[model samples]
Structure formats: structure tokens, C-alpha cells
Target: MTLYPVEAGNFKLDGGAMFGVVPKSLWNRTNPADSNNMIDIAARCLLIEEGDKLILIDTGMGDKQSEKFFSYYYPWGDHSIDKSLKKYGFHRDEITDLFMTHLHFDHCGGSIQWNKDRTGYEPAFKNARFWSNEEHWLWATQPNEREKASFLKENIIPMEQSGKLHFLEREKDEVFSENKELGFGVLFVDGHTDKQMIPHIDYKGKKLVFMADLLPTAGHIPLPYVMGYDTRPLLTLPEKKKFLETAANDNYYLFLEHDAHNEIITLKHTEKGIRLDKTHTFNEIFN
Candidate 1:
């Protein structure tokens, strides 16, 4: 199996919101903020090449949203899904599975795109089966006022309409099938978003976890640093605490989704609690 870091694009988000309850004095060192208080974030997706299946972990925010809509969050960067795929001698059509960690715009937006005429949207990976949990599918479709903005209909409806949408499990307890050789185990996290799936992959004798919003960046290793964007911050603390303990015990490598500087981080148990041991890109660990 081969892994490629597919960087769809970069965007700006409020650093305070990204690191809830964490002070600017602490987070600014990890990621400095611009004049607008927005920090650069990468919509970094993972592409898996395993035999006949080319599975894409998440899609970056697509370029379908209106400029006025995009004004809220500035999306920048030259890297794109196509460019990342091409770098590995692959194409959109080559992807057999689109494994979404969740349906958040940044995670699943690239799953769908504008049609040729631009009148309606269509699945970006025409040949791939878009995977999302049934509970998350329901939650996102009938989103609460707090999360409505994040779960845009344009990015989701296309997958269901195209008949490419498939559910991993209905209940939050059950996740993807466990195939030891596949090296990818799904960890369902609800604090970030409903049933958000974080893939724990066994790579080169190392346990590598795709840290979605549960632990967005290395700076978020602190137990209390949950995101303000989370619907349930209380639930996030325990979730993060449990995950970190396990990661520290297992010596797992965490792959950051939004961290522009640090791609991978290892956590060490500390008196103050868990702390970051080291930081590096995915390639550094894999190569």
C-alpha cells in the first residue's frame, strides 16, 4: 500500500475558534495569526493506494461556493486535488472509495463539484463510492442551526443523488470493518461532529492516526483545547483525553488535517498531562 498527501487547498480560520479555551499566547507560537486574526490552515486529505482500491480519506473545500459565501473564510493556495493526484500518477476516476471522515465542508466538499453547464452539482469522483455513517448522514441533512452553515446542501446532496453514497454503520458504536492487513481502523468520534471517523492506520510498524477535528493540530494536544466550532465542547474533553491516553500509550503518530506547519505529531505523557513529543510531515514518517 502507498500513501500520498493530497493537499486540495489552504484557507484561513480564526485561531481562537480553532483552539477553543486555549490562549493566543500559547497557540500563536504554533501558528501565528494574520491581522484579521485568521490563521492559515491546509485542507490536507489522504489518498490511499491499496491494490485495486484507491481510497481518498477526505475532500478539501471545493471551488463551487460563491465568492460572497467564500468571503467569510478565505480559501487560498495553489495545491489542488487534481495536482496532488497527478503527482502520484492517478486521477479522480481512479478513486474507488471516497471515505469521508465527516461531511463538514472542508472534509467532504470536494466529493461533489459543479456540472459542465454549472447549473447543478455532481459527484467529483464519478467512479468512487462515497462513504459516510448513516447517523452522520441524518445529522448533516437535518442540521441544527449551529451546524447548518457547515453542512451545506450543495456539497452533500450530490453524493446521495448520484447513488454513490454508502453508510459505514448506522449506530455510532459500529465502524468500518477491521482488516488488520488493510491497516486502517476507524475510530468514531462524536465530540467534533456526529460520528466523525478517524482512520488509525498501521504503517511501517507505526500506528498512524488521521487526527480529524478531534485533535486538529499538534497544539490541540491539551485536553481542554477543544474547538469553539464543536457543538458539544463538554463531550470533546473526555473524547480527547481518552484518545490522547491511548495514543501516548501506543506511541501513535497523529496526522493533522488543518495544521499548516505540523503534519504529524507524537504525544508523550507529562505531569501537566499529555504533550507533543515531536512534529513532522507524513512523508517523513512513511519514507
Candidate 2:
């Protein structure tokens, strides 16, 4: 299996919101903020090449949203899914599976796009089977008031409408399950959102985990630095602690999706608890 870092795009988010309750004085040291109090963020998706399967983990924020709508995020990069795919000598049509970690706009927005007529939405990757769990599908479709803004209908419904959506079966209340289709393990955690799947891939004798919203960046390494976007901040504390402890013990290479600068990271059990051991680029480790 081969892994490539597919940079979808880059943007800035409110530093305060990204690191909830954690004072600026502490967070700014790790994730320095700009004049407008915004911190750099990347929609860094991962592309996996195994046999004939080209599995894309997440699709960054698509370009379908209106300029006025995008202005709020302050986008700052030229990377696109198509362009990134071409860089590694592939195309969207060749993708067999589009496994979404969750249904947030920034994670799966690129899965659907405006049709040629520009009047309606259509599946962006015509040949890919879009993947999501039954629990998350229901939660995202019938979103609560707090998470309604994150779960956009335009980015989701079209996959089902196009008859290409499939759910990974999970036994009742199972937290971690093996996936036959993707040939990896998926850990379901509800602290960030309902049934958010974090893929754990066994590659090159290392456990590479896709850190979705569970740990947005290295700055959030501390236990209390959960994101304001998380629906259950209190739940996040213990969930993160358990994940980090395992990550440190197992020597997992955390594939960070939202951190603009740090692509991958490792943790060590220090006196202060789980702390960043080292940072690496995808090529540094894989090459």
C-alpha cells in the first residue's frame, strides 16, 4: 500500500474557537494567530493506493459554496482534489471508495459538486461508492440545532440521491470495528459528533491513525484544549485521554487532517502526560 498526502486547501479559523477555553497566551505559542486572531488550517486529505483501489479519506471544502459564504473562512491556498490527484497520476473517476471520516462540510464537501447545468448537485466522483455509517447518516440528516451549520444538505444528500451511498455495518454500540471493504479498523467516537469514524491503517509496520476532529492539531495535544465546535466538550476530555494514551503506547503516526503545518505527529508518555514526541511530513516517514 502507498500513501500520499492530498492537500485539498488551506484556510484560517478563529484561534479561540479552534482551541476552546484554552487561553490565547498558552495556545498562541503552539498555533500562533494572525492579526485578525485567525489561525492557519489545512483541509489535508489522505489518498491511499492499494492494489486497484484509490481510497480518499476526506475531501476538503469544495468550491461550490458562494464567495460570500466562503469569505467567512478566509481561504488561502490553490490546492484542489483534481489537481492533487493529477500530481500522483490519477483522476477522480479512478477512485473506487470515498470513505468519509464524518459529514462535516470541510470533510465531505468535495464529494458532491454542481452539475454541468449548474442548476443541481451531483456526485463529484462518478465511480466511487461513498461510505458512511448508519448512525452518522441519521444524525447528520436530522441534525440538532447546534450542529446544523456544520452538516450541510448540499454536501451530503446528493450521494444518497445518486444511489452510490453505502454504510459500514457495525454491531450495536461497537466503538471499534474491522472494516472489510477498506481493509482497516475504524474507531467510532461520539464526542466530536455522532459516530465519527477514525480510520486506523496498518502500514509499513506502523499504525497510522487519521485524526479527524478528535485532535485537530498539535496545539490541542493538552487534554483540556478541545475545540469549541465539538458538541460534547466534557466527553471529549476522556475520549482524547484514552486515544492519546493508546497512541503513545502503540507508537501510532497520527495523520492530522486540519493542522496546516504539521502533517503527522507521534506522542510519548511524558511526566505531563501524552505530549508531542516529534513531527514529520508524509514523505519523511514514507520515503
Candidate 3:
């Protein structure tokens, strides 16, 4: 199997919100903020090429949102979903599966795009089966006051309307596994968003995990660096701790989605805590 790092684009968000309770003195060292106090972040997506299937995990915030709406996030950078795909000699239509970690705008916004006629929205990848957990799907579709702004209906709905939406069933008492092959396996995490599915795949004998929001960057590997955007910050603490410990012990290479500079990180357990052991580009692991 081959894995590709798809550079969707970059956007800006408040550094404080991204680093949760961690003080600016700390997070700012890793992710510096601009004069406006917004830090640049990458909407880096992952492409899995195995056999006949080409799966894309988390489409970046698409270009369909209005200028006024996008002004808030400040989507910059030359890389884009279409341009990134073309970099690997592929196109949007070649994607067979669209695995959304959650329906948050930054993660799934590129899944749908405005119709050319401006009549309505349309599926960005017409041929792919869009995947989201049943619980998260409902949570995003009928969002609460706090998260409503992040879950835009225009970015969603069109997949279901296009007859491409599918939900992964929940195994309440047991962690879901990929006993049956369907491209890759999904690890459901709720600390960030309800039932956010992190894709775990075996690429060239190494286990690579698409770190959706679980570990947004290498800086977040430290137990206390959970994001403020998470609905359940307390829950995220243990969820992150457990994953970090496991990741360090298992030697899993975390593929970050929001990190502006760091693309991949591997952790090692230290006396202080789990710390980043190595920082490298996606090609180091795949090429």
C-alpha cells in the first residue's frame, strides 16, 4: 500500500483556542501567532492508495464558502485540494472513499463544493462513498449553539443528497477493528467531536495513524496540550494520554492535519511524559 500526503491548504485560527489551557508562552514557541493573534495551520489530508481503492481522509476547508465567511479563518497558501491531487497525477474524481474524521468545517468542508451554476452545492468527489459515524453525523447535522458555527450545512448534506453518505456502526462495549478489509480501519474518538473516526492503515509494514484532532500537532503530544475547541476537554485528556502511551510504545507515526510546519511525528515516553522523538516529512515514511 502507498500513502500520500495531500496538501489541501492553510488557514489561520486563534493560537489560544488551538492549544487549550496551555499558556501562550509555551505553544507560541511551536506555533507562532501573527499580529492578529491567529496562527497559521495546515488542512493536510491523507491519501491511501491500496489495490483498486483510493481513499482521502478529511478534505480541507473547501473554497466554496463566501469571502466574508472565509475572512474569519483566513484560508491562505498556494496548495489546494485540486492542486494537491494533481501533484500525484490524480484528480478529485479518482477518490473512491471520503473518510471524514468529523464533520467540522475544516475537516469535511472540501467534501462538497458549490455547483458551477451557483444553483446549489454538489459532491466534490462524485464517485466516492463519504464516511462518518452515525453519532457524529447526527451531532453535526443538528449542532448545538457552541458547535453550530463549525458545522456548516452547505459543507455537509450534499453527500447524503448525492446518495454517497455511509455511517460506520458503533460497537459500544468493544473497540472497532478492521477484521474485514474495506480499504482501512476507523478508530472512533469522541473527545474532540462525537465519534470522530481516525483512520489507521498498514503502509509498507508500518502503522500510520491520521491524527485528525486527537493530536493536532507534535506539541499536543504532551498530556496537557489538548485543544479548547473540544467539547469534552477533560475526556480528551485521558483519550490523548492513552493514545500517546500506546503510540509511543507501538512506534506509530502520527500524521498531523493541522500542524503548519510539522508534517509527521513519532513519540517516545520520557520521565516527564510522552515527547516528540522525531519530526519528518511524509516522504520519509512512504518513499
**Between prediction 1 and prediction 2, which has the larger lDDT?**
2
Off by over 4 Å in 3: 179-181
lDDT of 3 by residue, 1-287 (tens): 77789999998999899998999999988888999889989999988888898989899898888889889998787999888889899999999999888999999999999889999999989899998877888999999888999999998888889888887765674455462445677777778888887878877888888899999877777788889999998888888888889889999988999998999899997889889899989887778
C-alpha lDDT of candidate 1 relative to the true structure: 0.86
* Better-scoring candidate (lDDT), 1 or 3: 3
| Whole-model alpha-carbon lDDT for candidate 3 | 0.87
Steric clash pairs (candidate 3):
none
Q: TM-score for every candidate vs. truth?
A: 0.95, 0.98, 0.97
The lDDT for every candidate, in the order shown, is: 0.86, 0.94, 0.87
Candidates 1 and 3: which is better by TM-score?
Answer: 3
Ranking by lDDT: 2, 3, 1
The candidate scoring highest on TM-score is 2
Error of 3 at 242 (Å): 0.5
